[model samples]
Target: MKAVLAIVLCAFSAVGCGTRTSSEMKNIYKEDQDGVRRRDAKAEEMRYALSFGGCTYSLIAQNYAITAAHCSEESGALGTSGAAMAAGQKEAKDVQLDSLIESGLGSDYKIYKIKWTSKKYMKAQHIWTKFALKKSAVKLSIKPAKGDAVSTVGFPYDGEGQAIVSTGFLKKVSNYIVDPYSEIEGSGLYFNAGITGGNSGGPLFRASDETLLGLTVSGDTPSYYSPNRPESSWSADENDVWNIATPIWVVHEKSQAFRSIVQGGTP
Candidate 1:
Protein backbone atom coordinates (compact mmCIF):
# COMPACT_ATOMS: atom_id res chain seq x y z
CA MET A 1 0.00 0.00 0.00
CA LYS A 2 2.73 2.48 0.99
CA ALA A 3 4.83 1.71 -2.07
CA VAL A 4 1.96 2.08 -4.52
CA LEU A 5 0.75 5.27 -2.89
CA ALA A 6 4.26 6.58 -3.23
CA ILE A 7 4.24 6.03 -6.98
CA VAL A 8 0.93 7.77 -7.41
CA LEU A 9 2.19 10.81 -5.50
CA CYS A 10 5.28 10.91 -7.66
CA ALA A 11 3.14 10.98 -10.79
CA PHE A 12 1.10 13.88 -9.42
CA SER A 13 4.10 15.94 -8.35
CA ALA A 14 5.61 15.44 -11.79
CA VAL A 15 2.50 16.09 -13.83
CA GLY A 16 0.67 18.98 -12.08
CA CYS A 17 3.41 20.89 -10.28
CA GLY A 18 6.38 19.94 -12.43
CA THR A 19 4.93 21.32 -15.66
CA ARG A 20 3.75 24.57 -14.06
CA THR A 21 5.44 27.67 -15.46
CA SER A 22 6.38 30.53 -13.18
CA SER A 23 3.32 32.53 -14.19
CA GLU A 24 0.94 29.58 -14.00
CA MET A 25 2.38 28.61 -10.64
CA LYS A 26 1.44 32.05 -9.45
CA ASN A 27 -2.06 32.03 -10.90
CA ILE A 28 -3.47 28.46 -11.11
CA TYR A 29 -4.98 28.43 -7.60
CA LYS A 30 -7.88 30.85 -7.52
CA GLU A 31 -11.54 30.88 -6.53
CA ASP A 32 -14.58 30.02 -8.63
CA GLN A 33 -18.09 31.56 -8.41
CA ASP A 34 -19.18 29.32 -5.53
CA GLY A 35 -16.75 31.02 -3.12
CA VAL A 36 -15.90 27.66 -1.64
CA ARG A 37 -12.16 28.00 -2.05
CA ARG A 38 -9.69 30.86 -1.36
CA ARG A 39 -6.54 32.20 -2.99
CA ASP A 40 -3.33 33.97 -2.07
CA ALA A 41 -1.14 35.83 -4.54
CA LYS A 42 -0.13 32.35 -5.77
CA ALA A 43 -2.07 29.16 -6.45
CA GLU A 44 -2.55 25.90 -4.46
CA GLU A 45 -0.55 27.28 -1.57
CA MET A 46 0.39 23.83 -0.23
CA ARG A 47 1.57 20.60 -1.79
CA TYR A 48 -1.14 18.09 -0.79
CA ALA A 49 -1.89 14.38 -0.81
CA LEU A 50 -5.04 12.70 -2.12
CA SER A 51 -5.64 10.26 0.74
CA PHE A 52 -6.01 9.84 4.49
CA GLY A 53 -3.14 10.68 6.84
CA GLY A 54 -1.94 12.95 4.10
CA CYS A 55 -0.55 16.33 5.23
CA THR A 56 0.02 19.68 3.51
CA TYR A 57 2.26 22.72 3.98
CA SER A 58 2.67 26.14 2.35
CA LEU A 59 5.29 28.75 1.52
CA ILE A 60 4.36 31.37 4.14
CA ALA A 61 7.42 33.59 3.87
CA GLN A 62 10.42 33.79 1.55
CA ASN A 63 11.83 30.24 1.61
CA TYR A 64 9.98 29.16 4.74
CA ALA A 65 6.54 27.57 4.63
CA ILE A 66 4.43 27.58 7.85
CA THR A 67 2.99 24.24 9.02
CA ALA A 68 2.52 22.31 12.23
CA ALA A 69 6.07 21.22 12.94
CA HIS A 70 4.53 17.97 14.05
CA CYS A 71 2.49 17.87 10.83
CA SER A 72 5.57 18.70 8.84
CA GLU A 73 7.46 15.95 10.66
CA GLU A 74 4.68 13.35 10.69
CA SER A 75 3.18 13.70 7.21
CA GLY A 76 6.58 14.54 5.80
CA ALA A 77 6.91 11.18 4.03
CA LEU A 78 7.56 11.02 0.28
CA GLY A 79 4.97 8.26 -0.05
CA THR A 80 2.72 9.25 -2.91
CA SER A 81 -1.11 9.15 -3.16
CA GLY A 82 1.16 8.91 -4.70
CA ALA A 83 4.05 7.88 -6.81
CA ALA A 84 7.18 5.93 -5.91
CA MET A 85 9.07 9.16 -6.34
CA ALA A 86 11.13 11.02 -3.78
CA ALA A 87 10.07 14.39 -2.36
CA GLY A 88 11.51 16.08 -5.43
CA GLN A 89 12.05 13.95 -8.56
CA LYS A 90 14.75 15.98 -10.23
CA GLU A 91 18.41 16.30 -9.35
CA ALA A 92 19.16 19.28 -7.09
CA LYS A 93 20.74 21.08 -10.05
CA ASP A 94 17.43 21.15 -11.94
CA VAL A 95 15.51 22.94 -9.18
CA GLN A 96 15.85 26.70 -9.32
CA LEU A 97 15.54 27.31 -5.55
CA ASP A 98 18.20 24.89 -4.41
CA SER A 99 20.55 25.89 -7.22
CA LEU A 100 20.19 29.56 -6.40
CA ILE A 101 20.81 28.93 -2.72
CA GLU A 102 23.92 26.95 -3.56
CA SER A 103 25.07 29.37 -6.23
CA GLY A 104 25.69 31.65 -3.33
CA LEU A 105 27.59 28.75 -1.77
CA GLY A 106 29.78 30.83 0.48
CA SER A 107 26.74 32.88 1.56
CA ASP A 108 24.80 32.04 4.70
CA TYR A 109 21.42 30.25 4.69
CA LYS A 110 19.84 33.60 5.50
CA ILE A 111 20.97 34.98 2.15
CA TYR A 112 18.14 33.17 0.36
CA LYS A 113 15.71 33.36 3.26
CA ILE A 114 12.68 33.19 1.04
CA LYS A 115 13.64 30.14 -1.02
CA TRP A 116 12.20 26.62 -0.37
CA THR A 117 13.37 23.07 -0.99
CA SER A 118 11.37 19.81 -1.13
CA LYS A 119 14.18 18.10 0.71
CA LYS A 120 12.91 19.76 3.90
CA TYR A 121 10.08 17.24 3.81
CA MET A 122 12.04 14.44 2.11
CA LYS A 123 14.40 14.31 5.04
CA ALA A 124 11.49 13.13 7.15
CA GLN A 125 9.42 10.05 6.26
CA HIS A 126 5.83 9.26 7.38
CA ILE A 127 5.19 12.94 6.59
CA TRP A 128 3.68 14.40 3.41
CA THR A 129 4.62 18.04 3.30
CA LYS A 130 2.16 18.17 0.46
CA PHE A 131 3.07 21.65 -0.70
CA ALA A 132 0.16 24.12 -0.30
CA LEU A 133 1.29 27.71 -0.62
CA LYS A 134 -0.24 29.86 2.17
CA LYS A 135 0.51 33.57 2.49
CA SER A 136 -0.04 33.98 6.27
CA ALA A 137 1.85 33.57 9.48
CA VAL A 138 1.34 30.26 11.38
CA LYS A 139 0.22 31.61 14.74
CA LEU A 140 -2.61 33.79 16.05
CA SER A 141 -1.03 36.42 18.20
CA ILE A 142 -3.94 38.74 17.41
CA LYS A 143 -7.49 37.67 18.06
CA PRO A 144 -9.83 37.39 15.06
CA ALA A 145 -13.38 38.65 14.88
CA LYS A 146 -15.97 35.91 15.07
CA GLY A 147 -17.95 37.00 12.04
CA ASP A 148 -15.05 37.45 9.64
CA ALA A 149 -15.21 35.34 6.46
CA VAL A 150 -12.19 33.11 5.84
CA SER A 151 -10.81 31.30 2.78
CA THR A 152 -8.90 28.08 2.22
CA VAL A 153 -6.64 27.14 -0.72
CA GLY A 154 -6.07 23.41 -0.98
CA PHE A 155 -6.16 20.44 -3.34
CA PRO A 156 -9.49 19.18 -1.95
CA TYR A 157 -11.16 16.54 -4.10
CA ASP A 158 -13.56 18.23 -6.51
CA GLY A 159 -16.00 15.44 -5.67
CA GLU A 160 -17.14 17.31 -2.51
CA GLY A 161 -17.61 20.37 -4.74
CA GLN A 162 -15.13 22.67 -2.94
CA ALA A 163 -12.08 23.23 -5.12
CA ILE A 164 -9.01 25.38 -4.40
CA VAL A 165 -10.25 28.16 -2.14
CA SER A 166 -12.89 26.77 0.24
CA THR A 167 -14.72 29.60 1.98
CA GLY A 168 -16.07 29.61 5.55
CA PHE A 169 -16.76 32.04 8.38
CA LEU A 170 -14.94 32.39 11.69
CA LYS A 171 -17.47 31.03 14.14
CA LYS A 172 -15.49 31.51 17.37
CA VAL A 173 -12.18 32.31 19.05
CA SER A 174 -12.16 31.03 22.61
CA ASN A 175 -9.82 28.96 24.72
CA TYR A 176 -9.81 25.63 22.93
CA ILE A 177 -11.41 22.85 24.94
CA VAL A 178 -8.40 20.66 24.20
CA ASP A 179 -4.74 21.47 24.14
CA PRO A 180 -3.40 22.01 20.63
CA TYR A 181 0.00 20.51 21.36
CA SER A 182 -1.40 17.23 22.60
CA GLU A 183 0.35 14.85 20.20
CA ILE A 184 1.81 14.91 16.72
CA GLU A 185 -0.68 12.30 15.53
CA GLY A 186 -3.74 14.14 16.90
CA SER A 187 -2.84 17.81 16.63
CA GLY A 188 -4.90 19.42 13.87
CA LEU A 189 -6.91 22.59 13.17
CA TYR A 190 -10.67 22.23 12.73
CA PHE A 191 -13.16 24.50 10.91
CA ASN A 192 -16.30 24.31 8.78
CA ALA A 193 -15.75 23.11 5.19
CA GLY A 194 -16.17 20.09 2.92
CA ILE A 195 -12.42 19.53 2.82
CA THR A 196 -10.52 16.47 1.59
CA GLY A 197 -7.08 14.85 1.61
CA GLY A 198 -5.09 17.29 -0.52
CA ASN A 199 -6.27 20.08 1.73
CA SER A 200 -3.91 19.23 4.52
CA GLY A 201 -1.75 22.09 5.75
CA GLY A 202 -3.58 24.22 3.18
CA PRO A 203 -4.09 27.84 4.07
CA LEU A 204 -7.18 29.27 5.76
CA PHE A 205 -7.32 32.80 4.38
CA ARG A 206 -9.32 35.96 4.84
CA ALA A 207 -11.82 37.06 2.17
CA SER A 208 -10.53 40.58 1.42
CA ASP A 209 -7.13 40.92 -0.21
CA GLU A 210 -6.72 37.24 0.77
CA THR A 211 -4.98 37.69 4.11
CA LEU A 212 -4.21 34.34 5.72
CA LEU A 213 -6.18 33.30 8.80
CA GLY A 214 -4.78 29.84 9.39
CA LEU A 215 -3.43 26.61 7.87
CA THR A 216 -5.62 23.55 7.22
CA VAL A 217 -4.20 20.97 9.60
CA SER A 218 -6.74 18.09 9.47
CA GLY A 219 -10.25 16.67 10.11
CA ASP A 220 -13.00 14.58 8.47
CA THR A 221 -15.82 17.16 8.41
CA PRO A 222 -17.71 14.01 7.49
CA SER A 223 -16.32 10.51 7.74
CA TYR A 224 -17.64 7.89 5.30
CA TYR A 225 -15.58 4.87 6.33
CA SER A 226 -17.09 4.39 9.76
CA PRO A 227 -18.84 1.08 10.55
CA ASN A 228 -21.88 2.38 12.43
CA ARG A 229 -25.24 2.13 10.73
CA PRO A 230 -26.70 5.34 9.31
CA GLU A 231 -29.13 5.68 12.25
CA SER A 232 -26.80 7.69 14.49
CA SER A 233 -26.30 11.47 14.88
CA TRP A 234 -24.09 11.38 11.84
CA SER A 235 -26.21 9.83 9.11
CA ALA A 236 -24.57 8.55 5.95
CA ASP A 237 -26.30 11.16 3.80
CA GLU A 238 -25.92 14.23 6.08
CA ASN A 239 -22.21 14.84 6.35
CA ASP A 240 -20.49 17.14 8.85
CA VAL A 241 -18.95 19.91 6.81
CA TRP A 242 -16.74 22.30 8.77
CA ASN A 243 -13.32 23.99 8.71
CA ILE A 244 -10.33 23.80 11.07
CA ALA A 245 -6.96 25.47 10.83
CA THR A 246 -3.71 26.38 12.58
CA PRO A 247 -4.14 30.08 13.11
CA ILE A 248 -1.91 32.23 10.90
CA TRP A 249 -1.05 34.23 13.98
CA VAL A 250 0.53 31.08 15.42
CA VAL A 251 2.56 30.64 12.23
CA HIS A 252 3.80 34.20 12.37
CA GLU A 253 4.73 33.83 16.00
CA LYS A 254 6.88 30.83 15.18
CA SER A 255 8.39 32.57 12.20
CA GLN A 256 9.17 35.62 14.25
CA ALA A 257 10.87 33.45 16.82
CA PHE A 258 12.96 31.70 14.17
CA ARG A 259 13.73 34.92 12.40
CA SER A 260 14.84 36.38 15.67
CA ILE A 261 17.07 33.40 16.34
CA VAL A 262 18.63 33.70 12.92
CA GLN A 263 18.56 37.42 12.28
CA GLY A 264 18.32 38.48 15.89
CA GLY A 265 15.56 41.05 16.57
CA THR A 266 12.24 41.12 18.41
CA PRO A 267 10.69 39.25 15.48
Candidate 2:
Protein backbone atom coordinates (compact mmCIF):
# COMPACT_ATOMS: atom_id res chain seq x y z
CA MET A 1 0.00 0.00 0.00
CA LYS A 2 1.27 3.51 -0.75
CA ALA A 3 1.82 5.33 2.52
CA VAL A 4 -1.10 7.68 3.07
CA LEU A 5 0.43 11.16 2.86
CA ALA A 6 -2.62 12.52 4.67
CA ILE A 7 -1.98 10.33 7.75
CA VAL A 8 1.81 10.31 8.09
CA LEU A 9 3.13 13.68 9.34
CA CYS A 10 6.70 12.81 8.49
CA ALA A 11 5.79 12.25 4.83
CA PHE A 12 5.75 16.02 4.37
CA SER A 13 9.53 15.87 4.24
CA ALA A 14 12.06 13.51 2.76
CA VAL A 15 14.04 12.73 5.95
CA GLY A 16 11.07 11.52 8.01
CA CYS A 17 10.89 14.75 10.03
CA GLY A 18 7.98 17.17 9.76
CA THR A 19 8.49 20.10 7.43
CA ARG A 20 6.69 22.66 9.56
CA THR A 21 8.19 23.92 12.80
CA SER A 22 6.10 23.83 15.99
CA SER A 23 5.88 27.60 16.12
CA GLU A 24 4.83 27.78 12.48
CA MET A 25 2.09 25.19 13.06
CA LYS A 26 0.71 27.19 15.98
CA ASN A 27 0.72 30.37 13.94
CA ILE A 28 -1.00 28.70 11.02
CA TYR A 29 -3.90 27.58 13.23
CA LYS A 30 -4.11 31.03 14.75
CA GLU A 31 -4.43 32.73 11.39
CA ASP A 32 -6.97 30.15 10.24
CA GLN A 33 -9.38 31.34 12.94
CA ASP A 34 -10.49 34.30 10.75
CA GLY A 35 -13.26 32.17 9.18
CA VAL A 36 -12.39 32.89 5.56
CA ARG A 37 -11.09 29.33 5.30
CA ARG A 38 -10.32 26.39 7.58
CA ARG A 39 -10.64 27.51 11.17
CA ASP A 40 -10.43 26.18 14.68
CA ALA A 41 -13.37 23.86 15.21
CA LYS A 42 -15.85 24.89 17.89
CA ALA A 43 -16.34 23.06 21.17
CA GLU A 44 -19.48 21.31 19.96
CA GLU A 45 -17.79 20.21 16.76
CA MET A 46 -14.71 19.07 18.64
CA ARG A 47 -16.84 16.93 20.94
CA TYR A 48 -17.28 14.35 18.20
CA ALA A 49 -13.71 14.44 16.89
CA LEU A 50 -11.36 12.00 18.58
CA SER A 51 -7.63 11.69 18.02
CA PHE A 52 -6.84 8.00 17.78
CA GLY A 53 -3.64 6.26 16.77
CA GLY A 54 -2.39 9.29 14.82
CA CYS A 55 -5.66 9.53 12.93
CA THR A 56 -9.06 11.03 13.72
CA TYR A 57 -12.34 9.28 14.57
CA SER A 58 -15.91 10.22 15.47
CA LEU A 59 -18.43 8.33 17.57
CA ILE A 60 -21.38 6.94 15.66
CA ALA A 61 -22.68 5.28 18.85
CA GLN A 62 -21.68 5.38 22.48
CA ASN A 63 -19.35 2.44 21.94
CA TYR A 64 -18.80 2.58 18.20
CA ALA A 65 -16.60 5.09 16.36
CA ILE A 66 -15.91 5.65 12.67
CA THR A 67 -12.69 6.48 10.84
CA ALA A 68 -10.80 5.68 7.64
CA ALA A 69 -10.20 1.95 7.14
CA HIS A 70 -6.61 2.64 6.11
CA CYS A 71 -5.78 3.59 9.67
CA SER A 72 -6.52 0.09 10.88
CA GLU A 73 -3.97 -2.71 11.27
CA GLU A 74 -5.80 -4.75 8.66
CA SER A 75 -5.22 -2.05 6.03
CA GLY A 76 -1.55 -1.31 6.73
CA ALA A 77 -2.12 2.43 6.22
CA LEU A 78 0.02 3.75 9.05
CA GLY A 79 1.03 0.51 10.87
CA THR A 80 1.68 2.52 14.03
CA SER A 81 -0.83 2.37 16.88
CA GLY A 82 -1.38 4.69 19.81
CA ALA A 83 -3.89 5.74 22.45
CA ALA A 84 -6.96 7.87 21.74
CA MET A 85 -7.84 11.26 23.20
CA ALA A 86 -10.84 13.50 22.90
CA ALA A 87 -10.39 17.18 21.97
CA GLY A 88 -9.27 19.46 24.83
CA GLN A 89 -8.08 16.48 26.86
CA LYS A 90 -4.42 16.46 27.82
CA GLU A 91 -3.82 12.78 28.34
CA ALA A 92 -4.65 10.15 25.73
CA LYS A 93 -6.64 7.16 27.00
CA ASP A 94 -5.83 3.55 26.28
CA VAL A 95 -9.10 1.98 25.22
CA GLN A 96 -9.14 -1.64 24.16
CA LEU A 97 -10.55 -2.13 20.69
CA ASP A 98 -13.28 -4.74 21.14
CA SER A 99 -13.47 -5.02 17.37
CA LEU A 100 -12.17 -3.26 14.28
CA ILE A 101 -14.67 -3.67 11.47
CA GLU A 102 -13.70 -2.46 7.98
CA SER A 103 -15.73 -2.31 4.81
CA GLY A 104 -12.52 -2.96 2.82
CA LEU A 105 -9.56 -0.96 1.48
CA GLY A 106 -11.64 0.24 -1.43
CA SER A 107 -14.35 1.85 0.69
CA ASP A 108 -12.02 3.08 3.49
CA TYR A 109 -14.27 3.22 6.54
CA LYS A 110 -13.50 1.55 9.86
CA ILE A 111 -16.00 1.20 12.67
CA TYR A 112 -14.44 0.07 15.93
CA LYS A 113 -15.67 -0.72 19.44
CA ILE A 114 -14.19 1.00 22.43
CA LYS A 115 -14.06 -1.42 25.33
CA TRP A 116 -15.22 0.18 28.56
CA THR A 117 -12.08 -0.65 30.54
CA SER A 118 -9.57 2.01 31.58
CA LYS A 119 -10.22 5.14 33.63
CA LYS A 120 -9.30 7.17 30.58
CA TYR A 121 -11.99 5.36 28.67
CA MET A 122 -14.44 6.17 31.45
CA LYS A 123 -13.50 9.82 31.30
CA ALA A 124 -13.91 10.04 27.55
CA GLN A 125 -17.12 8.02 27.81
CA HIS A 126 -18.55 10.51 30.29
CA ILE A 127 -17.86 13.33 27.85
CA TRP A 128 -19.46 11.44 24.96
CA THR A 129 -22.50 10.56 27.03
CA LYS A 130 -23.07 14.16 28.04
CA PHE A 131 -22.65 15.36 24.47
CA ALA A 132 -24.99 12.68 23.18
CA LEU A 133 -27.62 13.66 25.68
CA LYS A 134 -28.05 16.87 23.73
CA LYS A 135 -27.17 15.88 20.20
CA SER A 136 -27.27 12.19 19.42
CA ALA A 137 -24.36 10.73 17.52
CA VAL A 138 -24.32 12.33 14.09
CA LYS A 139 -26.99 10.88 11.85
CA LEU A 140 -26.07 9.67 8.36
CA SER A 141 -27.44 11.58 5.41
CA ILE A 142 -28.50 10.36 1.98
CA LYS A 143 -25.77 10.36 -0.65
CA PRO A 144 -24.65 13.93 -1.21
CA ALA A 145 -24.65 15.53 -4.63
CA LYS A 146 -22.24 17.81 -6.41
CA GLY A 147 -22.31 21.39 -5.09
CA ASP A 148 -23.69 20.22 -1.74
CA ALA A 149 -22.12 22.17 1.10
CA VAL A 150 -19.86 20.17 3.43
CA SER A 151 -17.40 20.57 6.25
CA THR A 152 -14.55 18.37 7.48
CA VAL A 153 -13.60 18.25 11.17
CA GLY A 154 -10.37 16.65 12.34
CA PHE A 155 -7.06 16.97 14.15
CA PRO A 156 -4.73 18.13 11.39
CA TYR A 157 -1.05 17.54 12.12
CA ASP A 158 -0.34 21.27 11.93
CA GLY A 159 -3.03 22.05 14.48
CA GLU A 160 -1.15 20.59 17.43
CA GLY A 161 -4.01 18.17 18.20
CA GLN A 162 -6.70 20.85 18.14
CA ALA A 163 -9.69 19.97 15.99
CA ILE A 164 -9.94 22.11 12.85
CA VAL A 165 -12.90 22.55 10.53
CA SER A 166 -12.77 23.24 6.80
CA THR A 167 -15.85 24.02 4.72
CA GLY A 168 -16.36 23.49 0.99
CA PHE A 169 -18.77 22.15 -1.61
CA LEU A 170 -18.73 18.63 -2.98
CA LYS A 171 -17.02 18.54 -6.37
CA LYS A 172 -17.94 15.07 -7.61
CA VAL A 173 -19.02 11.55 -6.67
CA SER A 174 -17.67 8.39 -8.30
CA ASN A 175 -16.30 4.93 -7.81
CA TYR A 176 -12.54 4.74 -7.09
CA ILE A 177 -10.93 1.44 -7.90
CA VAL A 178 -7.98 0.73 -5.63
CA ASP A 179 -6.86 -2.19 -7.74
CA PRO A 180 -7.83 -2.51 -11.37
CA TYR A 181 -7.44 -6.28 -11.38
CA SER A 182 -9.69 -6.83 -8.35
CA GLU A 183 -13.32 -6.09 -7.52
CA ILE A 184 -12.27 -3.68 -4.77
CA GLU A 185 -13.82 -0.28 -5.36
CA GLY A 186 -14.35 2.80 -3.21
CA SER A 187 -17.15 5.34 -3.35
CA GLY A 188 -15.26 8.59 -3.53
CA LEU A 189 -16.61 12.00 -2.52
CA TYR A 190 -14.30 14.63 -3.91
CA PHE A 191 -14.14 18.14 -2.47
CA ASN A 192 -11.80 21.11 -2.08
CA ALA A 193 -11.64 21.15 1.70
CA GLY A 194 -8.21 21.83 3.19
CA ILE A 195 -6.82 18.66 4.78
CA THR A 196 -3.38 17.27 5.56
CA GLY A 197 -1.54 14.69 7.62
CA GLY A 198 -3.38 13.53 10.77
CA ASN A 199 -6.74 14.48 9.22
CA SER A 200 -7.36 10.96 7.97
CA GLY A 201 -10.41 9.16 9.37
CA GLY A 202 -12.11 12.35 10.52
CA PRO A 203 -15.77 12.94 9.80
CA LEU A 204 -17.03 14.95 6.85
CA PHE A 205 -20.41 16.49 7.71
CA ARG A 206 -23.18 18.22 5.84
CA ALA A 207 -22.68 21.92 6.35
CA SER A 208 -26.37 22.63 6.74
CA ASP A 209 -27.44 20.04 9.32
CA GLU A 210 -24.16 18.48 10.45
CA THR A 211 -25.21 15.00 9.40
CA LEU A 212 -22.48 12.48 8.64
CA LEU A 213 -21.46 12.37 4.98
CA GLY A 214 -18.04 10.78 4.66
CA LEU A 215 -14.59 10.08 6.10
CA THR A 216 -11.42 11.97 5.15
CA VAL A 217 -9.19 9.77 2.99
CA SER A 218 -6.46 11.71 1.17
CA GLY A 219 -5.63 14.96 -0.61
CA ASP A 220 -3.76 15.95 -3.75
CA THR A 221 -0.06 16.37 -3.43
CA PRO A 222 1.50 19.74 -4.26
CA SER A 223 3.25 18.56 -7.39
CA TYR A 224 3.15 15.72 -9.89
CA TYR A 225 4.76 14.91 -13.23
CA SER A 226 5.99 12.01 -15.32
CA PRO A 227 9.47 10.78 -14.29
CA ASN A 228 10.63 11.42 -17.85
CA ARG A 229 9.72 15.10 -17.62
CA PRO A 230 12.39 17.45 -16.23
CA GLU A 231 10.06 20.12 -14.92
CA SER A 232 6.74 19.56 -13.06
CA SER A 233 3.93 19.45 -15.59
CA TRP A 234 1.24 19.87 -12.97
CA SER A 235 1.16 21.46 -9.56
CA ALA A 236 -1.76 21.56 -7.17
CA ASP A 237 -2.69 25.04 -6.03
CA GLU A 238 -2.35 25.04 -2.28
CA ASN A 239 -5.33 27.34 -1.95
CA ASP A 240 -7.58 25.22 -4.11
CA VAL A 241 -6.63 21.54 -4.10
CA TRP A 242 -9.08 18.66 -4.29
CA ASN A 243 -9.23 16.05 -1.55
CA ILE A 244 -10.73 12.55 -1.47
CA ALA A 245 -13.15 11.10 1.05
CA THR A 246 -15.07 7.88 1.51
CA PRO A 247 -18.80 8.37 1.50
CA ILE A 248 -20.52 7.02 4.61
CA TRP A 249 -23.10 5.37 2.40
CA VAL A 250 -20.38 3.02 1.17
CA VAL A 251 -19.87 1.71 4.67
CA HIS A 252 -23.61 1.31 5.17
CA GLU A 253 -23.79 -0.69 1.97
CA LYS A 254 -20.69 -2.84 2.46
CA SER A 255 -20.50 -3.67 6.18
CA GLN A 256 -23.33 -5.57 7.80
CA ALA A 257 -21.56 -5.22 11.14
CA PHE A 258 -21.49 -1.45 10.73
CA ARG A 259 -25.13 -1.36 9.71
CA SER A 260 -26.09 -3.48 12.73
CA ILE A 261 -24.24 -1.22 15.13
CA VAL A 262 -25.60 1.94 13.55
CA GLN A 263 -29.12 0.54 13.74
CA GLY A 264 -28.73 -0.14 17.47
CA GLY A 265 -27.98 -3.83 17.11
CA THR A 266 -24.86 -5.72 18.17
CA PRO A 267 -22.24 -6.43 15.52
Whole-structure CA lDDT of model 1: 0.34
Model 1: per-residue Cα lDDT over 217-266, one tens digit each: 44432323342533133421121334455554444333444334234332
For candidate 2, lDDT tens digit of each residue in 121-220?
A: 4434322211111112333223332356678887666666667787755666656654334646666777656666667887777656556777888762
lDDT of each: 0.34, 0.55
The clash number for model 2 is 0
**After aligning candidate 2 to the native by TM-score, how far in Å is the CA of 30 from where it should be?**
10
What is candidate 2's TM-score against the reference? 0.67
Q: Which number leads on lDDT?
A: 2
List the lowest-lDDT window of 10 residues for candidate 2: 126-135
TM-score of each predicted structure versus truth: 0.44, 0.67
* Residue 125, model 2, lDDT: 35
Candidate 1 lDDT score at position 245 = 59
